[model samples]
Target: MEAESREAGPSAALMSAIVTEHFVLQSAAGTTVSEALGRSSLYLSALSSSLIALGFASQTPGLLLPFAAAALPTVFVLGVFTMVRLVGTGVQNVLYLSSISRIRGYYRTLDPEAARYFARWGAGEGETDDALGSLAVQGGPMAGLFTAASMIAIINGVLAGVCLALLTYYVVTDHHLPAALAVGLFAAATSLTVFFRYQHRRYLKVQQ
Candidate 1:
């Protein structure tokens, strides 16, 4: 049995190393996702703030309305893009979490003794590893309310509101029926966008 034991020892060590590597890779990936989410949020916030400042400095409300109208569609598109990115980031989080759980299961299979390490404090109900998992791989704005998806949603909502208000003001000042109708249409469009977007996200979740 000595020869058989020697062969099995190397195989077991190799399997342990592979499992460790998988865990480390998932951890690293989670860190990268956190970083990207943070950077994207900052960039979008800065850009929107700068544009608002510029619009005000121009000191021409009439001209500003036109420009804001032109920019409205682009802002809406960007918000949608941010939402897509957020969905991807969320998926990554789930995948990493699933991988980690599988690894934990594998550990339990290999050595039942390791189960205590994952226990949750006094419960010993197999919750220790969960506490470890709760530790942040990366923390900052990404972990907070200032995520890219949220920022973009806020910016887009503000833009839609401003555009509608400006259009209404222009209609009142110029007494133009076409402009008034356009304002109504814009309001409808904004409402539809928000409603449909929520529905779409819900659909995606259901699909998953």
Candidate 2:
């Protein structure tokens, strides 16, 4: 009985440690999500306020150009910073989830009977593979575009195009509306493509 108790002691301590670690990872994941949402809210609020101010400025005749010249660039830059941090938080959350999944795998090993309870939890044949496979099927290829970070990116891209259009109208093309529109559309498309590609690469890096 003494020898049996000695063997059990270490196993019990290890399981306790595992449980604590699992809880910590879950908490960290939640924190990352919260941070992402908060940052997104901040950015969106700023963008909306700037737009409203611009709307008012447009009514003042000569104030429109000067106001947009200052406001659009500032808001666009803020959007860039916000989008980048959002992507970081998203990646961090994924990593935390991956760690939690690994810990759950340990739980299954300790109690084979408990595996049934975890079957729906994305354990799959291995720790991460099946979970990712299931996610891919459910989310599809365009799922990344639906994230908060992607939403910000799209808005930022449009802002960039608008800025370029204004510049073209006032400076480059000398108030040619058609030329400004063409340039703006091209800028918007290019910006979106670059943002989407960057996001895809970041996610792929996380998976690797």
Tens digits of lDDT, candidate 1, 48-78:
7658865685697557656666666566566
Residue 198 local lDDT, model 2: 79
Model 1: per-residue Cα lDDT at residue 10 = 43
What RMSD, rounded to one decimal, does every model reach?
A: 7.2, 3.1
lDDT of 2: 0.79
lDDT of candidate 1 at residue 97, scale 0 to 100 = 55
Give the residue spans of candidate 1 off by over 4 A.
1-10, 13-17, 20-24, 120-151, 171-208
* Cα deviation of 84, candidate 1, in Å: 1.0
Question: Model 1 misses residue 201 by how many Å?
Answer: 5.1
Which regions in candidate 2 have their CA more than 4 angstroms from the true location? 1-10, 120-143
Window of ten residues with lowest summed lDDT in model 1: 120-129
* Number of colliding residue pairs in each model: 6, 0
Full-model lDDT for every candidate: 0.55, 0.79
Clashing pairs in 2: none
TM-score of every model versus the real structure: 0.58, 0.87
Residue 125 in candidate 1, Cα distance off native in Å: 12
